[model samples]
Target: MTLAAGSLCLGGIVLFVVLAAGALLAFDEPGTANDGATFDAYVWRVARFTLLQASLSTALSIIFAIPVTRALARQLSFPGRVWVLRLMALPLGLPALVAALGLIGIWGRQGVLNSGLAWLGLAQPVSIYGLSGILIAHVFFNMPLAARLMLGGLERIPGEYWLVGTNLGMRPWSIFRFIEWPAICGLLPGIAGLIFMLCATSFTLVLTLGGGPAASTIEVAIYQALRFDFDPPRAIALSMLQITVTAVLLISIRMLTPKADEGHGSGRMVRRFDGRRGLGRAGDGLVIAIAVVFLVLPLASVVSSGLRSDLTKLVTDPLVQRAFLTSLVIAVVSGLFCVVATAAMIQARQTALASRHPTKPLRGLASGISASTSLVLLVPPVVLGAGWFLLLRPFGDVALFAPLLVILINMLMAMPFVYRVLEPAIATHSARTGRLAASLGLGGWNRLRFIDWPGLRKPFMMALSFACALSLGDLGAVALFGSQDMVTLPWLLYSRMGSYRSTDAAGLALFLGLICLMLTIAGTPAADRNDKRKPDAA
Candidate 1:
């Protein structure tokens, strides 16, 4: 039964992608024949810009992250170090639109940076729009992520390496060369690839900050083709191009990066002898301080600026109220669907593994199911929305099913994350309790209720909260499907920003940020708990 349910969910994802691709292909035939040259030029321009920005963004992020990660690894016991690590996680979960707004508060024409420059007697104020703004935002979002991943790699380095280096009286540079560089190298390809994929497929950040066509990415171009130009054929062409690019990148990343073993550590900090004083300590301190300010300032701006806005009026406004309600409902439904689907998949995989002599096909099926969940990432939300937009247009008004489509797409988007969060907890629970429950004749719902819920509750809630937060902040599908009746908070915030209603947008960004922040904070404890269980599991 579990396998059947899991297969059904996996099949739904496959059908969704196939139908979207089919619709895109079918729609392109007539239009491509006539506008092939125009389409080709336009796609080339967008694709070129997309790769350029993604490459630059990826480069900048990794470059900055190396120094920061090295600093973090060297300065292990600084004041507020724990809080600094926590701050890094903020950008990962923060909404793109909110982060963009916070950045504008710091870098816009009349923003803090410009004011500071003017005070310093500079005549020209720097612009935070176009390519510059996009790169900044991508770095703001991805740099910390790269640093964290690298830090994990650094942390996994055994203490003996550092001890050996200390015994030889190696300088800081030698320590980095012999001890840290090798660990970082192993992770760099995978980390770089992930950041590049994120930047290449970035939708909300690009759409929000991309000032004009010159700076626009393929994802933003796809949005413009559909919404601004009313050109479904162009949208189809762009969608296909993005799908091709994404699939190729995924393949390249897989081929370049070997899968590493998931080894559990003793959770003990490696005491390092280098960077204890003088220039090294000072440099690490400076790097950590800059990183903290860069990340925290925008979030601080969100809160301060938001509080200065007409909060009472914004909250009481009918449209704002409705958008919030709509966002809430959609987020809740999507989260529930994601958790349920992930649970089914996990159950099926566990059942397959539990088999004493599982057939090769059975093992393949289990692996395939896991891969399929992640395959959703290959098809960006905008591509899915565009394909579905074309598929449903013939039937009638697509706006009627906008909420349904958004929920489904968001659920699929959040499934891989939910799977990661819950799979471990569920597996651990089953391993510990399976035999006892079976011996006592427990099965089905009763077994799950009696044996699973107690241990699984925290992880389950964590996954649900994370899924909901992701759905709530999503702007891609809703940007395509949103109409008069189906306004979500992200769509509303984007509209306000476009309309130059900066005050209102600030207020909305604040509210959205707070909610996502709360949900993220709520989910962290479960993740910590899960991490603690890892050593035991190993």
Candidate 2:
């Protein structure tokens, strides 16, 4: 059953990419006998420019991340350190539209930076429009993520490794090179590929900051063709090109993903002075300060702007009320759906693997199931929305199914993160309990309740909470399929921001941030909670 579900998921993903691309590719006349001559030079030029910019953006973002990660590893728990690490997660949850708005609020002509410069009697110089602005925002968003990923790798190096280093008199740089780097090197390719993929597909930031046609990404170009020109062929062509790139990069990501190491264990990593006392402390301080300023200041701008807005609007706006209702229903329903699916997956694994599986077929099935769990990352929001829409349109009213659709897509979106969070505890529980249960003639719920659940309660609750938070902040499929009646808070905020209602957008951003922060806190416990985490990651 698990194998079959895995196959279905893979088939669904492949068909969506292929059909979407093929439909768009067919817009061209294949028999233009002068085929080479018939190729549009303008499209070729745009595609080239798109690839070039994405490549540059990815390179710069990852490069800056090194210093940011270095600082975070040592200084995650200073006065405001926990807040800084928490702030880093905002961009991942940020809707592209809101992020663009925040970017403009600080860097646009009338923005804080310009206004502040004028106050300083300096030239109002350096435009936040075009290539430079997009690059900076991408770095702003990505550096923290890279740092966290790298920091996770460093932390897994058992405290014993640090002790051994201290005994051997290994210097800070030497310790990093010999012990830390080797462990983290495995994650670099995967992190870079993930960041590159995100940059390549970025639509809102590129559209908002790229100034004009000269700096747009392929993703924004696709949106323009579909929304502005009503040109299905061009949209399809662009989709095909994206599929080619995404497919390649995602395959590489899969090849490189580490073995499951949940624990959401990356909360506020202020492991002070694992290296040297004075030098390490200074280095950690500098890194933490830079990260906090970049990640938190824009957020402060949002909140400060929110304070200036008419607070009554949140209650008085009928649309806001309706969207709030829509979002709540969607979040609860989606969280339940994800919980059920995860439960099903865990149960299926237990059933099949209870016996010491030496059979090749069973082993292959388990591997495929694990890989299927990873598919959520490969399926982009728009692609999943488009596929399910086509598959279901003939039979039902998609508008009526808006919330359900949102829940379903969100389940997919939340998979890898959910799996990453739950897998470690699940693996430990399965390892310790399965053998004992089999020997004791324990089976079914009896074993689960008596042995497993007690051990896994923390990780399970943690997974559900984070998964819910993920669904709540999601803007992917919701943007494409959600009607005015089915609007989520993020989608509604995007609409307001899109229409230049910055004050309202800011207020909503602050509200949404609190809600998400609350959920994250409720769901995932910090590394301190799970002290026995096996200090090994693939």
Candidate 3:
């Protein structure tokens, strides 16, 4: 029964993709063929820009991350280290638009930096627009992610290795070469690939700061073709191209990354034996200071700027209230859907594993089901939303289904993360409880309540909360469906930004940030306590 339910959930995902892609192919206008000259040129331009920005963003994120990771790894017991780690998690839940605006608040032409420069009698040193702005935002988010991942790798290094380096009197650089570099090197390719894919598919950052055509990415191009041009054929073509690019990147990431569970660990607190010299400490301090400012100041701007906004006015506005309600409904519904689907998957895999004599076919089926959840990563939300729009257009009003469609997309989007969060916990619980349940002839609800519920409750709730937060902050699918009647919080916040209501946008950003932050906090206790995790990453 559990296997059947899980199979149905997997089938639902497959069915939606098939329907979306088939609809696009079916309804694509033949007229686009004659305009091939213009279309091809446009496609090539955006494609090149996407690759260029993604590659550069990936390189810069990893380059800066190495020093930051080195600093954090060696300086483990600082006064505010735990808070810095917490702040690193902020970007995961922070809406992209919020991050973008916060960045602008500090780095824009009339922003804090420029005002400070004016006071200091100096020229403005930088512009946060076009390619430079996009790069800055990408690095701001991804560098922390890379640093955390690398720091995890560094922490996992055995104490004996560091002790040996210390006894040999190895310098920081030499110790890094012999001890840290290998671990970092092993993770870098996967890190770079993930960052590259993120930048290539970035929509909110590109949409807000892309300045002009020269900076547009494939995602923004898809949005334009769908919303601005109303060109189904071009949109379909762009989506296909986007999928192709993402598929290649996903495959490359798989190949480059170590097959073992290489990330998302609550790393053990370990002592380091090196990098204690005054010069070394100074270098580490400098890198740590720069990274903190780069990441924290934008967020600080969000809080400070948001505090100045009339919160009562922004929150009480009818449109803002309606959008908030809509976003809440969608997030709750999507979170429920993801949790149910993920539970089904866990049950099915556990069933397979607990069988007395596991067969080849059963093993293959379980593996395939697990892999299917992650397949959503290859289809960016922009491409998926655009494809679905093409599917629904022939049926009359797509806006009528906008909320429902967004809910479904959000479920799919959150599945991979949900699986990542829950899988290890579920596996550990099942292994510990399986024999007892079987001995008592317990099954289904009895087994779940008596055996699984107590052990798995924290991770389950954590996964649900984070999944909801992810849905709350999403802009990609919502961008495709947003209308006056269909406004979500993200969509509403974006509308405010578009209309030059920066104060209102900041307020909305703060409200949205608080909601997501609460959800993330609700989940953290469980994650922190689950140190016995065995990686079952999807």
Candidate 4:
């Protein structure tokens, strides 16, 4: 049953790819998979803007995150410190539309800051549109994500290092240079790569804020081609280009970040050691405070508005009702598919491994490599969606599959995260019991019964709940296919925002946020209730 579901899920994604290929092949008869030549202007201009914005966004976010992470790294004894860390984490999980809304609330023309500026007799506040708005939203959502991930790295060095550095008479600058940097270096590639990927693939953020032609990214361009123009040929060509760009960057990212992404999920062991005293602390504190203000305040405002907004009318709309149902069905199906696909892929790797070597050491190495393939970790959501969409749409009306297709795309999109959660537990079980199971001559169903099921109860369940949470909040693939009759919760919220129905949008955002939060919280009980507490998957 599990394997069957897994096959169905992966099969659906494959089907989508095939459809895209068929579509492209049919549409572009003799045409190249380049939106170039005829649209030389769009090709160069979009590429230029995409690269420029991504490079600037990544650099600026990381730079600004440094001081913020430094201050937040100080273990606070006060109330709400933990909440502050969670606020940072929340952005990682926030649907893009939610973050975009928060940004607009503060930076929009009638926003608090702008309104205050006008009262102060300023000529005019700067526009929160085009490059400026995109940059602000990107930084607002991503900077904290980078900072928190980095903060976890800073806290992982053994406390003894601090004492040792002090004993060796190392000054704070020397301590940071010699001790902290080394400990955190292993994590930087992963964090930086992940951030770069997220920035590169930004979709809803760009769409919601890309005020004009000048600010459009590849994602927005693809959306325009399909949604506005319904030009399959141009969309397919654009998709191919986007994939090429993403794949090239990802190769570099992989070379830079092959290590497993693990530390951030675990609790940190924080310490007190400012690299400098006095003004340094103030500067660091200011950065951290700014991070909190930027990340948290927006969500708080969203929750407040999301709650206060009159929801009765929108919630009752047939379109909203149908979208909600479609989203729920898709999320459940995708989550189940993720669970099975993860299991099958893991099993395939193991099947290859066990047949090759019976030795524990060799098996360990193979398992490690196979597990790391889950490093689908580095592929961002939009990139994957674009690649598969380009590769599949030619054969059929992708709109026929629509929302369910979105769910399948999202599962493939989420494979890396689910695999990370399942890898270690699978490895441990194989290490301890593989030989014994072989000796018993266990086969197929029996193998899963005797070897896999017993050991995976907690982690598997945890993985499921999380997979559900991810699918529930997913916005990218759906962004491609979702329409008036086929929207998900995120798309519905986005539609509301575009129509300038702020109150309805807020209510929908609150609804979506609650659904995500509940599923995430439920995952804990599913994992923890087990008597077995396996180590976290890397």
Give each model a TM-score: 0.95, 0.79, 0.93, 0.83
Best-fitting candidate, scored by TM-score: 1
Global Cα lDDT for candidate 2: 0.68
Clashing pairs in 1: none
Off by over 4 Å in 4: 1-26, 29-36, 76-79, 258-285, 355-398, 432-455, 525-538
lDDT of each: 0.88, 0.68, 0.84, 0.70
lDDT of 2 by residue, 424-538 (tens): 7787777777678889998767977888778888887777777777777777667666665678888888778679877888878776766776777777655664577432211
- Judged by lDDT, which candidate is best? 1
Q: Which stretches of candidate 1 lie over 4 Å from their true place?
A: 28-35, 261-269, 526-538
What tens digits encode model 3's per-residue C-alpha lDDT throughout 84-137? 776776797788888998999998987898789888988756688899999999
RMSD in angstroms between candidate 4 and the native structure over all alpha carbons: 5.3
Each prediction's Cα RMSD? 2.9, 5.6, 3.7, 5.3
TM-score of 4: 0.83
